[model samples]
Structure formats: C-alpha cells, structure tokens
Target: MKINSTVLLTLILLILMLGAGSLSAFLGFTLGSSALKGVSTPDGRPTTKFASNKATNAQQAGLTLLKEEEILKIVKARIEGKTKAAKSEKLDEDDEETKSSKQKPEEKPQEVVEEKLQPGFPVTAENQGVTLSVQSVRYSGGDLLLKVKMQNKGADSVRFLYSFLDVTDDKGRTLSASTEGLPAELPTNGPAFSGTVSIPTALLDDVNKISLSLTDYPAQKLKLDVSNIPVARVAGLL
Candidate 1:
C-alpha cells in the first residue's frame, strides 16, 4: 500500500492553497467589519462621519470655516471703507485749497491816465529884439504839441539850434522834447519861422505847469523865457 510520489506532492500543494484562501478571506471580513463600525452610530445605524474631508481638515487645523458669500461680503466692506477714506482725504485737500485761494488778494495793474494841454495858450516872450511865441497847444498821438513862431528883429543874422532849448516842469524837472519845421538860421528882420515842439505825455504824469527858455547860438545875446503853460489831465480816459 505505498502512494505515488506525484500524488503526495499534489495533495500537499492543494492543502496549502486552501489554507491561504481561508486566511485571506477572514482578514478581509475582519477589516470590513472594523471600517463599518468606525462609520456607524451608537444605535447601529450608518453615519456620514467620514464625509466632507474639507470640513474635517478645517476642524483638525482649528480654523474657522466661512461660506463663499460671507467672505465676499467682508472683502467688499473693506474695499468700500478704503474708498470712503480716500474720498474724505481728497475732500479735505480741496477744502484747504479753496480756503487758501479765498485768503489771497487779487492783483491789479497800474493805470496810466492820459493828459492834455489846457486853454489860455499863445503865450509870448521876447528879449533883445527876438520874440518867441507859443501860438497853440494840442495833443497828437499821445504827445503834447506846441506850435511856436520865432522872429529875429535884430541888425545881425542870428543862428538858432533847437537842441539848446530848455524845458522844465513845475517841479523843476527837465523834460525831453523834439522840434520840427524850424529854420536853423534867421536873417535880420526875416519872416517869422513856425515850428512844433513835442513833449511826451508820459513825462507829464505829475506835471501841472511848464516853462520854456531859448537863446541864440554862438552869441547867446538874446534870452527868451515862457512860463506858466498849463497841463490838464482828467480821469476816466484810457
């Protein structure tokens, strides 16, 4: 009654396979029952204790959980607060600027009033057979113009240079003037020479009266002086 060697080896292998299968099946059942117990309530009912991994993680980390809507509301409130603060700062700056502008005074330009020669002209002065007359006085192109006539009634020829003419204001300040249409030389008993003496209105700003003096050139034997010529400047003209 001796068994074959092949049959003995096959029987041993079959026993080992059955034992491994049983052991694996028991281990799987035990692990499954432990997992079910972990997720079950005390009343033997199934529970969702392992659900919502995010909430579980939050709890573990000791962090407060907030809904999306609540987060958005907080962010919006912060933004609105910042905007209001910026607006308030800008308004304060604008108010300060307005107050500064109101406290300063406005500047005005200096006004230059025009002047005119008054009436009672045609003044006359004579010395040593020489006569100087102011025939008229008027305004031309912002200048005070005086029409003058000169006569040499002497025995010798007299030379005249208007560059030597002296003109002064009431304050004894010298005035600048220009002359035109006058002869350089006057013969004895010659025809009366007429000319114009122009004075700038700018020099007459504070002048109320003027004086004029003239003398012959090279000889200077004759001296003519005209005084008390009036200058009038009224307001309201540009």
Candidate 2:
C-alpha cells in the first residue's frame, strides 16, 4: 500500500506542473498581444494619440513654411514697388527738364554805344550878378562829368535850381544831366562854389557839339547861355 501511494502521488505532482507551465505560457502570450494592441492600431498603424500629434506637428510645419513664403513675397513686393516708384520719379524729372529746355529761348546781350571826348573846356557865361564857368571835364562809368564853378558877384543874394538847367546836343535833342556838390542859394558876394554835372555818354554817341543854358527859377529873370562846345574824336579811345 505504501509503494502504490507513493507512485500515485508522483504522477499527480507531474500533471500539476505541466498544467501550471501551459497556463503561464498562455498568459504571457495574451499579455504580449494586449501590450502590442495598446501601442498600435488594429490595422498595424500607430495609436490615435500619436498619429494626431504627428499630424498636428506636420500642419504646424506647413503653416510655418507658408507664412515664411508669404512674408518673403510681401517683402519682395514692397522692394519692387519702391524701385518702380524711384524709376517713375526719375522719369518725371527727366521729362520736366526736357520740357523746360524746349520752352525757353536764349537771350542776347544789348550793345553798348561808346563815344569820344575832345579837349575844349573851361567855358564861361555871365548874367546879372551870377557868373557860371565849366572848369574841367572827365569820363567815368560810361558818363561825361563836367566840373563847374559859380560866383555871386553882386550885393544881393542869388537862388538857383540846377535841375532847371537845360542841355542840348548838336542835333537839337535834349540831354539828361545830374548835378552834385552845389548849393541851392549863393550868398551876396560869396566865394565861388564848385560842383559836378554828369551826362550819360550813351546820348552823345553821334554828337560833336553841345549847348548849355540856365536861368533863375520862378523869376526866370537871369539868363546864361553857352553854345558851340566842340567834342572831337580822340584816337585809341571809344
């Protein structure tokens, strides 16, 4: 009985060990399959969370690339616009210059007429209590300058307006004259007063002789006249 019981116990222990090993192998295979299912989709694709994250990342990258392209395009457009504007401005300036050049005409300088002066001077005239004398002559700045002196010889005072002095060329044309360094009134028995008379040489271009006449203003009582003053041509001067 003891031997039979020992054999039966050994067989029982061997069956239990086989069954436990089979169950352990099956559990390991099932757990491994479950772990694979957790990491991957049923069609062998990645998990939904991982795929969604990857797709979002790709979309963001594409958006970034598009934004970069858009920014580059905007910058290029602005640069090209500025370049075109500058070119347009330059063309407008060139057009304006061309129009201005075509519109205006050139001007010529006026001709200056010159004359010659002779040597006859120191002409004198007397009227009432006044004596008028042309003392000297000179040429300056396209004008003929005459130095003159006046004396009040009588007892009474004498008043004169040099503006009323009349000058005429040989051709009977009146000439303009300006005077300086002369007094409006000459006292009684006063010393001689010196002055200058300037006449534009342009008016004397064809004249050879001139006449001068003077009289007291308002009264017109005193009269002095000198005529036939010759001005001959001089060589080496115009």
Candidate 3:
C-alpha cells in the first residue's frame, strides 16, 4: 500500500506542471498579437493617448495654415479691386475736365473788321483835284486809328497840310494826343491810296465834330467835317 501511494502522487505532480506551462504560453501570444487600441507605431514606443494627441495637433496645424492662406487671398483681391477703382475714377475726372476745357470760348479769328461807332462820322476833303475820304475810326492802346482812303482825279497828287487837321469838343475843349509828334504818312502810290491814320485816343472824349482844312496856298481851301463818329474798342487782346 505504501509503494502504490508514492507512484500516484508523482503522476499527479507531472500533470499540474504541464497545464501551468500551456496557460503561460497562451497568455503571452494573446498579449503580443492583439495590441492595445491607440498605439500608433509598430515598435509600440508611444502610448495610445500620446499618439491621439499628436494626430489632433497635426490636424489643427494644417487647418490653421489653410485658413490663413484663404484670408490672405481675400485681402489681396480686395486691394487689387480698390486700386483699379481708384484709377477708373481718376480717368473719369480727367475726361470731364478735358471736355469742359474744350467747350470754353476763345478769341475772334480776324485781326480787325469794320465797326460803325458813335464817336466819329465819315468825312471828305478835296483840294487841287485830290480827295481824302475818312471811312471809320476807333480807339486802341491810348491811340485813335482812322481808316482813310485817298484819290486824285486830277493830274497831280494832293497834299495834306500839317497842323490843318484839328479835333474840337462842343465845349471848345481842344483834345491833345500822345502821338502828336508823328507826321502824316501819305501813300506814294499814284492816283489812289488807302491806309489807316493814328492819333491820340483821348481826343475823342465828348467830341462833337473834327475838321480838316486843305488849302492850295492862298488860292482855295477844301473843308471836311467828321461828326458823331463812333469809337470802337480793341478786340483779340486783353
């Protein structure tokens, strides 16, 4: 009975040892193959929580970069639009100014024209078959200019006596001229001549009539009268 009890005890101990070894091997294989849920790398160096935090941070950074780029593009477009609008406004203003300038009035095209004025009237004088015709008169630059046409129906050219042309107001006021020192300039063209005569503009003030007495020595005298002839203003100049 002692010998049989010892053999049975040894067999029981060997079976327990074999079962413990199989349980240890099964637990090791399960832990290695079925990994933890959030671990990222194959080496399993990062914890599951650490890997999740890293992924969240990378996503946030990428989103922030994209938003900044969108904002920059919007700002750039706005700036470009503003610049173009300013240029367009300036061009419109310039075009309007140019149009206004073009519509403004300008000076007359001709140098002079015939004007019937109230300060003086046409007059004529004849001496030795020579006739002097005064057409029109005007004032400019403190001087009086007269349009005079001269003709000789006779053989010889007639002369205009110096100191014979005189200006007088109705009040007997003798008007003086700043250009009184200038002598009469007669045309040398034979038989017919036409020109303008210049004198002092101040002489026509409140004047009624001007007289020119042409004489042939002590023989005869031809008298001409200019009355109420209008004086014209100068044009084309300031």
Candidate 4:
C-alpha cells in the first residue's frame, strides 16, 4: 500500500519517540547505578567525599594544635609556680637569720664577799722581866722582796729570835714557810721590826690568810700569838 507524505511523517515521528523513550530509560538505569556507587562512603558521607576528608584532616590538625597549646600552658604555669615558691622560701630563711642575728647574748652576775675581824683579849707574854705586845701587822711586796711589818707596843726591849712568817690558805692549811735568818732581833725604841720573807708565787694563791708568829731567844719556849695579820697582794710577781 502507498502511504501519503503526511502519514509517513507521522509514523516516523512516533517510532522515533518510542525509541528515544526506551533509550532514555536504559541510560537512566545504568548511570544511576554508577552515580550511587560513586556517591556512597563506608562512613555514610554522601556527595562531598573529598571535601569531608579534607575537613576531617583539618579537624585532626586543629585538635593536635590545641593539645600542644594546653601542654605548653601547663608547663609554663608549673615553672612560674616553682619560681614563686623558691622566692618565698628564700625570703623566709633570710628573715629567720636576720631575727637570730639581732638577738643579744646573756650576761653573768657578780659575786660579793664580806671581810671578818678578829676577837678581843689579845695574847700576851712576859720574858726576862720584859713584856711585849704585838700591835698591827702589815705586808708589803712587789717583786722578789716580801716584807712583814710588826709593831711592838710594849715598853721594854725584847729579842725576836728566829722569827718566821707562815703563809696559809683560808682553810688553815699552810702553803709555804719563810726561810731562816728572817729578822735577828727587835730594838725596843726603834720602829717595830720589819722582816723580809721569801715566798714563791706558786705557793701564795690567796695571800689574805698569811700569819706572822714570833719566838723569843732567852726562853725559846713560848710562841708569840700574832694571827689575823692583814696581808696584801701584789700582781705581776714571779
């Protein structure tokens, strides 16, 4: 059968339309699978895989930077705290030392001793019709010369034979004895007999208790009682 030109054109158009629709449906299925495969991620991100990865890397870098900053801040704080503590400790030590230096030392007290005098009823003696009273007794010495002054207050002349000075301590213990030939005799009218006694410095630590006793020649039995003599001490004597 012969077809008109208008009908032929219509038929061709319909065929072309149908073929295009079928081709479109096939292409949509094939491309949809490829697009779905390309868009899917294991972690569930959809359209922006490359951008998401870049964002994740950036976030990790930012976290690392923040951790580093935190650590540095902690270290700085620790250093500053240690420095302040050391400064405070040094100040406290210095203050304690200053207080100790300003403190004063303690002082010792002084001691006082009173002097005692002898009792009354002085000792008396008579020999060869003459009586001699022993008066004040005194001591004098500097270097090697130690002398005792004995005043005779009696009216008659008496011979002081073998007179010796006995030096003793406070406890009545004899420390030293004077050598012989101290003073031969005492003239009645002359100033009371003065005798030079030799005593080493080691023997006389305390010279306050030294006694001077006299013995007469004719009798040689009676001892002159002349204790409690006022003894003096001289320094730098060897």
Candidate 5:
C-alpha cells in the first residue's frame, strides 16, 4: 500500500527529532562520565577529588593574599616608625639649639699691672754740700715712678726735702707733686738717699716732660733746675 506524502514527511521529521535528542543525551552522558573518571582516584569509588582540588587552589590563593597583606603591614609599620623617629630626632635637635641660643655668656674683669720704664737718662744736680740724681723712670698702674739718689758730701749733715716737681706740656699746663706725697725722705748727714716719686699718669702725656726744681735746699731757698726729662718715646711714656 502507498503512504500519503505529507504523513510520511511528518513521520520522518518526528524520527529525526527523536534521534537528535537521543544523540545529545548520549554525548552529554559520555562527556560527564569522562570528566568524572579524569578526577577520580585509582579506586572505583565516588570521590570529591575535583572539589578538593578547587578548594585547595582557592585556599592557597587566600594564603598568598594573606601573606602579601602581612608584608604590606610590616613595610608600612617600618616606614611609619622611621618617620616618627626622624620627627622625634628633629624635635630634640631643635630644642637643644633653642637652649643654646637662649643661654648667656660669662663676663671677665680687666686687671691692671705694673710695668717699669726703660731707656732712661741720668740727671744730676750738685750744690755746695749736697748732691742729687735721678737715674730711671718706671711705671706701675696709673703712676710714674722716679728712681732718685742723694748724698751729703760736705763736712756737716744736711736734710733734704721735696722741692718742686712739675710736668709741662706745649700748652704749659703744669701738674706738680706735693711734699706730703713725695716717695723719699733724706735725713741729716745721710750719706745716700734713694727712693721713688709717684706721679699720676693722668697728669702727663707722651708729649709732656717733667722738671724737678729745688727752690729750697736744707734750710735755704735756692732755685735750681735739677732735672728736665722727657718720656722714653714720643708716643708712650715707657
């Protein structure tokens, strides 16, 4: 018997659809079983090997991430520690500098000492019975010292006292020494009289000269120019 063409076509389509579905199901089962076998252990038993591998991989990744985070934390802490130490050190240095800047310095006092004059000339004066001489001029502090020698060369004793001691400048301003302030005293019949005469350095200058005039000897008033002396130099007295 001859079949209708449309019905025959419909039957062929249904068979093809059924065969395609069966083939797809067979392929899916085969692939799924093959994957399962690849992940299984040697024993023919159900296994979670694939799942265990996936979990292990994920755990290893987590550990790596955790280690990296710990390293970052350590590095950050070190950097912060160094920064803090640097800041603290700078602060200490600044404090020390400030203290040094605020502190005051100590003061020292000036002391004056004595010094002798040099390159002096000898000046001599003689009378009928007494003779006087000045050999050197010395200096100490603010005073000038004169080294004088005297002698009684006559048959009788004679007393010698301070006569006139004066310093003169170009302006003729005179500063004289008094008898009460004289540094030496001559006795009667004294063979030799040796002493000093202190004159204020303020009363004289480098350009000034001193003149010792004795207008009064033992008991008589007689003017005599004993000494007219200049300073050691034109600049300083000694």
Candidate 6:
C-alpha cells in the first residue's frame, strides 16, 4: 500500500522528537555525573588545598613519630652511659681500696739460734773421759729450756755422780738451774745422752747468758751461749 506524505512527515517528526529527547536525556545524565563528581561530601567543600593539608598533616605526624623515636634513642643512650659510668666508678673505688690495703705494715719473722758445748774436766788418771754439749736453747712459757747432750769419749764407761745446769740473766741473776739429783749418765763409746733443763720464768726476762757446769762428774767444765731466744709475748703463769 502507498503511504501518505503527511503521515510520513508526521512519523518523521515524531522520530526526530524522540531522538532529540534521547539526546537531551543522555546529555543531562552526563552533566549530572560530572557535577556530582565535582561536588564535595556533605560535611564541607572540597579542593586540592584540603587534600594538600591532609597530606601535610600525615607527613607531620610521621615526622613527629620519627623525632620521638630519636629522642627515645638519645634517652636510652644517656641511661646506658650513666650505668657504665657508675660501674666504672665502683671499680675505681675497689682498686683504690686494694691499693691502700697493700700499703699497710707487715709483720717480721722470728729468729732462732743454736749453740754447742764441750766438756773441760778430767775423767781418768791420764785424760778426760767424756764431754758435755748443749745443742739448743728455746724460750717457752716465759722461761728458757736447755737441751743438753752428753758424750762419753773415754775408752771406759764413766758414771756422772753429780751435775748441774745453770742459766743467768743480763743482770747476773740466775734464771734456771738443775741440781745433782737430776744427773744424766752415759756409757762409753755409745750414743750421747740427752737431758732438758728448764729455767724459771721470773728471771727469763733479764736472762742474757747461760752456764752449764758439772760439780762432781768426771767432766766438770761445760758452758753454752743462748741469748737470742725470742721473748715470750704472753705471761707464763697465765
């Protein structure tokens, strides 16, 4: 069927109007989208300056944390240094104490001396029989104790009838003495006979000399020196 021109024109116009409406709707949607994108949040307006301010705030916070960390490190270093200095000071103090202790006075050692004695009296019709010797003298209990060893040098045995031991102080005071009752006898050509004689404590302080003599024995003359004995620090009676 052949279409009328008016109807065709009317159809064309309606189509054009629809197209224009579509175009206007699409442009409106595009403009609305662009405007919405350009708008800020409901709280306030938006700008590059605001974004820059947020970034600056973030950077400043980070810088503040860094500065705080640096300050903390410095404080920690200072505390460690103080602890080390304290320890060093303590060590120096101990060293000084040790040095001072080493400078104190020291004690001296005690000395000991020995003496020997020989008989000087006649023993037989021709010659002397034996000799008496004092080997050592020691001071103990505020007194001096003499150790005497006698030897019989004669060919025959000799018996000591009576003997005596004596010790004198620096003032000629008799410190110690043994009578004949305490005589010690020895056999001929045998080992020496040993005996101990003790002096009184009262005379020990002034004792500077010692004498050992035999009155009735075959060998009578005998003597010894014992002046280097250490003085007793404590009283003998106590």
CA lDDT, candidate 2, residue 170? 94
Off by over 4 Å in 2: 1-119, 233-238
List where candidate 4 sits over 4 angstroms from the true fold.
Answer: 1-146, 151-155, 163-165, 179-182, 206-208, 221-223, 229-238
Model 2, span 1-238: residue lDDT tens: 9999999999999999999999999999999998887485355556877898899998888863458889999999999999999999999999999999999898789889753333565678887778887766666898887778898897778788988999998999999999999889888899999998888998888987777888876688888887776543455322
Point out the higher-scoring one by TM-score: 5 or 6. Answer: 5
Clashes of each: 0, 0, 8, 0, 0, 1
TM-score of each: 0.47, 0.47, 0.35, 0.31, 0.40, 0.34
Between candidates 1 and 3, name the one with more favorable TM-score. 1
Q: Model 4 — which ten-residue stretch has the worst lDDT? A: 115-124
Which segments of model 3 are wrong by more than 4 Å? Answer: 1-121, 177-189, 216-228, 232-238
**Candidate that would win on lDDT:** 1
Structure candidate 1, residue pairs in collision: none
How much lDDT does each candidate structure score?
0.84, 0.82, 0.61, 0.56, 0.66, 0.59
**So what's the TM-score on candidate 6?**
0.34
**lDDT, candidate 4, 117-229, per-residue tens:** 22321233444333333332323352223344444445554555443434555568775555433345555555644445555556555565445455666755535544554
Give the per-residue Cα lDDT of candidate 6 at 57.
94
lDDT of 2: 0.82
lDDT of 6 by residue, 47-116 (tens): 8779979999988888634588899999999999999999999999999999989998786787676433
Q: How many backbone clashes does candidate 5 have?
A: 0
Which scores greater on lDDT, model 4 or model 5?
A: 5
Error of 2 at 34 (Å): 88
Point out where model 5 deviates above 4 Å: 1-120, 163-171, 178-189, 221-223, 232-237
Per-residue lDDT tens digits of candidate 3, residues 175-198? 543222222433344545666656
Candidate 1 residue lDDT tens string, 1-238: 2568888998999999999999999999999998888485454333545455667887889966899999999999999999999999999999999999999999889789853533575788987777888876766698998888888898887888899999999999999999999889888899999999999999988888888998889788788899987666544211
> Which parts of model 6 are misplaced by more than 4 Å?
1-129, 161-163, 179-183, 218-238
The local distance difference test score of model 6 is: 0.59
